[model samples]
Target: MKSKKFILESRVKDRVGFQIERILENEKPHLSQGSNFLATIGLVEPFIGLYIKYSC
Candidate 1:
């Protein structure tokens, strides 16, 4: 079960990183402030998830 959870989290972090990289590369020039904020959120979300998961 722990291995499964770790795998899932790893996959999610990879996906998030990929999506943020895509957004920064493709849409950064035209992105508004709100979009930049969302991108920041994307980058931080995985850490937040891990914190919450282990804080219990």
Candidate 2:
């Protein structure tokens, strides 16, 4: 499996909302202010472990 790390922008800070924004910003096209929040954020290992009891 591949490492699922954020492709962080040089300009953006590494934090909750900004991390989510970076994910969306790297989409095939581009980002606007009104992009869907749910789609942008993703689940990575630490969060998955905190949320679920079983291995994925």
Candidate 3:
């Protein structure tokens, strides 16, 4: 995950880890999808893009 993907404070980068740790410690929010979409998209999209770029 890129730092400041959610927050863009001037000095937020220094606290990114602490921010996530706080969320995990307090909010405990879950990141998920209905299927394997999130997991496979990272692999599949890049493959498709490479195939298109090199094949055509």
Candidate 4:
């Protein structure tokens, strides 16, 4: 079995990957830094699921 630290690190990487994907996917012309910041913080609703699902 994997160690707790390893699993936690893996989940953190996955969460970051998920967030990056979300940011890139939703980015478009005329979008502001505030919008991207919101996406990064998971405040836009859809992006929060990854954190919820992968959280320890």
Best by lDDT: 1
- Candidate 4: give the clashing pairs: none
Clashing pairs in 2: none
Model 1 per-residue lDDT tens digits across residues 24-52: 88876776748879999999999999999
For model 2, how does the per-residue alpha-carbon lDDT over 1-56 read when each residue is reduced to its tens digit?
Answer: 12333345423455767879878778736544435563455435557767686654
lDDT, model 2: 0.57
Across 1-56, the per-residue lDDT of candidate 3 in tens digits comes to: 46666556646765887788888777533444334677788869998999999997
In candidate 2 the C-alpha lDDT for residue 29 amounts to 66
Q: Which has the higher TM-score value, candidate number 1 or candidate number 2? A: 1
Q: Write model 4 residue lDDT over 1-56, tens digit each, in one string.
A: 56998999999999999999888878854467577777766755665776787895
Selected candidate, larger lDDT, 1 vs 4: 1
Deviating ranges (above 4 Å) for candidate 1: 31-56
Candidate 2 local Cα displacement, residue 5, angstroms = 26
Model 3 TM-score relative to the real fold: 0.37
Give me the runs in candidate 2 sitting further than 4 Å from their true place.
1-14, 28-56
TM-score rank, highest first?
Answer: 1, 4, 3, 2
**Residue pair clashes in candidate 3:** none
lDDT of 1 at 35: 87
Q: After superposition, how far is residue 7 of candidate 4 from its true place, in Å?
A: 0.2
lDDT of 1: 0.92
RMSD of 1: 18.8
Model 4 whole-model lDDT (C-alpha atoms): 0.80
